[model samples]
Target: MLMDDDLFSSRPEDPLASLARQDLDPLSQHELDERIAALEAEIARVRAHSEAVAKHRSAADALFKR
Candidate 1:
């Protein structure tokens, strides 16, 4: 009974969650270091987006203040 929009709106499994469950024991030291660097970069990207979103929300709230 699901509509087309409902089917497409559902997200696939979160890759970050999948990555956390991955077996890291098999990775070499260099591989682990590379993974750490990639994760750090992703963290920075997420933080920047979060700050931008917060600023946007704050501006919207200020504009609509009663």
Candidate 2:
């Protein structure tokens, strides 16, 4: 099951969050580790994307100001 931690964390009022809070089948140690790794990679990717977008916006704003 591909779980998106960001989506899950962001929507506290979502029904899925309620389900997630309930005690359910747990992931194996290996699966847990893999999920953590994937989340970390996703966080890095998102950070990089945000940085690039900020850089582009800053450049555009500078050109407009000149």
Q: Which one wins on lDDT?
A: 1
Could you tell me how far off, in angstroms, the CA of residue 59 lies in candidate 1 after the best superposition?
Answer: 0.5
RMSD of 1: 4.3
In order of listing, the candidates' clash counts read 0, 0
Per-residue accuracy of model 1 over 1-66 as CA lDDT, tens digit each: 999978787788799799889999999999999999999999999999999999999999999999
Note the Cα lDDT for every prediction shown.
0.95, 0.80
State the lDDT at 26 in candidate 2. Answer: 75
> What would the per-residue lDDT of candidate 2 be over residues 10-59, giving only the tens digit for each residue?
64678647745865357888977886797789889999999999999999
Error of 1 at 15 (Å): 1.4
In candidate 1, what residue range of length 10 has the lowest lDDT sum? 5-14
Candidate 1 lDDT for residue 3: 95
Residue 44 Cα positional deviation in candidate 1, in Å, after optimal superposition: 0.5
TM-score for each candidate, following the candidate numbering? 0.79, 0.62
RMSD of 2: 10.1
Query: Which pairs of residues collide in model 1?
Result: none
